[model samples]
Target: MATTNIWQQFKALIPEGVRVVATIAANNGNGTSQAELRDGSVITVKGETVNVGEKAFILDGEIKGTASSMAQYEVEV
Candidate 1:
């Protein structure tokens, strides 16, 4: 659980899994798929039915939902 405390009250921020955006590179066809992150790293995302080449929000190896397909720009600071 991701928690944050404000005024001595605890609140959960990211309920499950780390928030990450990845593109589905391959669908294993058994409810599991391989996703590629923005850094060109590949990871296996399980328990979500996803299509190839679709960007998705992954958490705890599960799909929270789809993400925007717009072009992404990173600023190096």
Candidate 2:
């Protein structure tokens, strides 16, 4: 008998949504920031001070929900 890994089997359970992989290109230093995504699209987020060069996840050009630092989702797999 072999043991099965539940994580591997359930990994697909993660919902697929609009996930933007981008880097903070600029910060206005006034609660506004801009990120340049891999797809060559720039999105703006206000009320958040994202440092330049910092990787971030943004959805719908807002960081209110479904957004956070990329480091937070790092998985040691």
Candidate 3:
């Protein structure tokens, strides 16, 4: 069975421009392990699980995927 992280799945279900506080625990091999906000800053997530302390405001275009050719779609925070 494929196990995907809760943070990853939760982030994926949300639409753009929504304000969210999330903590990245594990990356699903897509390069990013944390939530990206509307801003232009890539925050590095650490640990196997995240809690209230690790929560952060979602930055714009911070979620980096495996698509190396999708650079044009990135938004500057």
Candidate 4:
């Protein structure tokens, strides 16, 4: 018989989600809104609390909450 390892068991549970910063582009006027990432790519996220032209934190295609306007920098070693 096969055995389930710790890593396998962990995978079964709800894993952590990845959050990204984005700016509100447009509001669908329902419960979702359009947001734009730093890369100039746009994505639809769920949330209308944040106004247009504002930054927010998106996770799992849902809006967790508003985000700061601090600048971001990529570093390489």
Candidate 5:
């Protein structure tokens, strides 16, 4: 599937009030690397590594559970 649709599907599944957690142990390159979660804090498999010219992981954060404090951490490569 394409990136946008996958993201849209993810958004659809998540309830409005639910919290989502995003963490990273290590990352390189520049574009977003998506991890395959397996009910663990760490990604089950190594994600695809994009390049420096692309965008950073826009989803890294600890969910705030509130509307205002939506924490977003951008790690510069």
Candidate 6:
């Protein structure tokens, strides 16, 4: 299947009000970071973090909260 189609299918599986934790894939160093969601969508988050691989709870293009590491955040999710 095509990648876009596959992503859509994965997104459909997520129920409403269920928040997904995304990892900070890349930080632009300009108050923005590229976050990779569970559905494979890259969201632009406005935040400042020296930790590149940190996990964060994002909603509507904003970082609501963050964790020390991905493993620690995954436990809460």
Which stretches of model 2 miss by more than 4 angstroms? 1-17, 64-77
lDDT of 4 by residue, 1-77 (tens): 54569787777686588788899999899999999988999998888988899898899889888898987889999
Q: In model 4, which residue pairs have backbone atoms overlapping below 3 Å?
A: none
**What is candidate 3's lDDT per residue for 1-77, written digit by digit as tens?**
54478888888788867344454444545444644433644455433233323444443524322222122365689
lDDT of 2 at 56: 66
Give lDDT for model 4. 0.88
Q: How well is each residue in 20-71 modelled by candidate 6, as lDDT tens digits?
A: 5788899888888898876788888877563567788776676767854534
Q: What lDDT would each prediction earn against the true structure?
A: 0.81, 0.66, 0.44, 0.88, 0.38, 0.73
Backbone clash tally (model 1): 1
TM-score of 4: 0.74
Q: Roughly what TM-score does model 6 have, to 2 decimal places? A: 0.54
- Scanning candidate 1 in windows of ten residues, the lowest lDDT window is 7-16
lDDT of 1 by residue, 1-77 (tens): 53355633433332544889899999887888899998999998885666788899898888778888999888999
Per-residue lDDT of model 5, residues 1-77, tens digit only: 55677788899887664234433334433433433222544441233342322222323332222122255566889
How far off is model 6, as Cα RMSD? 10.9
Top-down TM-score ranking: 1, 4, 6, 2, 3, 5
Candidate 2, 1-77: lDDT as tens digits: 54388886687678655666577888777777888876778877764545677676666665443244544344697
Q: After superposition, how far is residue 77 of candidate 1 from its true place, in Å?
A: 2.8
TM-score to native of every candidate shown: 0.75, 0.49, 0.25, 0.74, 0.21, 0.54
Give residue 39's error in model 5 in angstroms.
2.2
**1 versus 6: better lDDT goes to:** 1
Instruction: Name the lDDT of candidate 2.
Output: 0.66
Q: Identify the leading candidate in terms of lDDT.
A: 4
Error of 3 at 10 (Å): 30
Each candidate: RMSD: 4.4, 8.9, 13.9, 3.9, 13.7, 10.9
